[model samples]
Target: MRTALTEMLGVEHPLVGFNRSPAVVAAVTNAGGFGVLAASMYSPTELDAQLTWIEEQVGGRPYGVDLLVPEKFAVSDPDDLVASLRAQIPAEHFAFVDALLDEYGLPAHSAPRGEEDALDEIAAAINPAGAQALLDVTFSHRIAMVANALGPPPADLVSRAHADGVVVASLVGQRKHAVRQLEAGVDVLVAQGTEAGGHTGTVATTVLTPEVVEVADGRPVLAAGGIATGAQMAAALALGAAGVWCGSVWLSSEEDITPRPVKEKFLAAGSSDTLRSRTMTGKPARQLRSAWHDAWDRPDAPAPLPLPLQPMLAGRAWNRVHAAAAEGHPGATALDTYFIGQVVGGFTELRPAAEITREMVEDCTRRLRALGELADT
Candidate 1:
């Protein structure tokens, strides 16, 4: 309970929960774990409002903000990148999506939305400007830390955070990435493995966590990926992590905003059912292996558009598919999917965020005590 992360964030536990919902973030932080509200899914203005709302709800509890600043992204000039990527999306993809909808026998839209509107929606939804917007709000608020999910925080961003006296952290899938982030002057390293949900690397957590700890050179390292249980948290700490960065386990919790159908799919899914597919987002993100991934990964399928474009192409279709899935439509069910890590297999029930946080602490304490007794022997 008094580990470096808890001390750093002024929380009661070393657990960090990453979620997109503001409610879930507040709940986790109030429960003593550092709640990280993912900012990639909002525009700058929207993120500002969300962070402001979070500040009101959490009542000054220490929480953090997460941004997606990928080390390698398709866009060079953010604006031109958005524009060019918009033009590159083929109309055929729309046709395929429409046909899929028809197969589901869902109500057809009276008129199709324009490509620009669709593109702008997705870009705005996961735009980099959201990161800048969140930075502005976080620096203005009592945010304890700022994290970059996809890569090292940009130099300017990292500099700004440090200048504001906020601890900066980045997620890395490999030791090389950890070194790169450290050299960039990140305060903490999040060692995420392939078992993580969303974007992840291929390395297993059992091997990657210690490797990252070794490379961190005493900087705090949070082990991520495939760590849902308290025993898993204890294993991460025993493996040299200063804390645990958990995401997937929270998806099925009561505080989580994940839809019921999607949550059910995750609950029924095993660790092996998910796949690393680049079809949804431009980069490889692990999601429930559904017909959507299957359709996109087919040999004849067009290569996924770049970061903002691919999401642009799929976002509306996804929304429609998800709505249909909620209605129990067959075609929608084929495509309704969400990201969850391999630890999803461990998610046997839905509980409150506070209960989950408490259980993790209790279980971790028990496991560590057992290990200490073994050492005494």
Candidate 2:
């Protein structure tokens, strides 16, 4: 409990739960672990309300916020920005999406009629502006950290967080990426492996964590990917990680707000059920293999569009899938899925978040003690 990560986040435990729902964030923090709310999908006003509510719910417990600010994307100019990028998304992709929906027997819904309009919706939701708004709200509260979900936090954002006394962190999949993040003045490094959920890289944790730690040079490193159990957590620490950044394991937790169908997929998934694909978010992200992934991978299927574009293309269909999955529709069930790591194989049952965190800590503590005894020999 007194590990470097605990000190950094001011939490009793080093277990940090990253989730989109405020309830899970509050619960994890209240349970003595750091809870980080994903702010990528929220509007400025919505994020403000969410952070305010979380502050009240956690009752002074430390929490964090995650924002998506990819340094490389189409838009660079501030003038035609969102409009220009949206126009670049070919109409063929939308036509392909429409055809896919018809083939899947899903009903059509009115989507953004124009390219610029669609990109505007995505930019409003995920751009730096969105993160800045969230930061305004997060700093208003007592959040302990502000993590960029993708690449390095923008220098200005880092300056803002530092000025506000919040630690800046970024997720990295490779040693070089870790070095880049540290050079960018990031305070914490989350070394997430290919086995991690959501957007991830190809390296496995066993190989990636130590390399990241080496590069970070004592900067706090949170090992992520294929780390669902306490033994895995212990292995991470043994590999020089300061803590574990856990995501997939919490999807089945009682406190998790993941939709029922997606939750079910996670519960039933084997470690091999997941594959990395850019079909959902235009980045290589680990997600449960489903008919959806298969369709996207089809030889004839159009390549997935870039970040905001890809999500925009699939957002309507994904929304429909979630809705139908809620209704227990079989077709929707076949399409039901979300980002999860290979560790999802170990997630066979739903447990309380607090209970899961406790068990992991206890098991890791016990295992660590055994390893310590082995050193005596």
Give each prediction's root-mean-square deviation over alpha carbons: 2.4, 2.3
- lDDT winner: 2
| Residue-wise C-alpha lDDT for candidate 1, range 273-314, written one tens digit per residue | 899987787778888898787777667667776676777777
State the RMSD for candidate 2.
2.3
Point to the candidate with the largest TM-score.
2
Error of 2 at 197 (Å): 0.5
Q: Give Cα distance to truth, residue 101, candidate 1, Å.
A: 3.1
Clash pairs detected, candidate 1:
none
Q: In model 2, where do residues sit more than 4 Å from their true spots?
A: 76-83, 110-124
The weakest ten consecutive residues by lDDT in model 2 span: 115-124
**Model 2 Cα lDDT, one tens digit per residue, 182-236:** 8889999999988999999889899999999888888899999978788998999
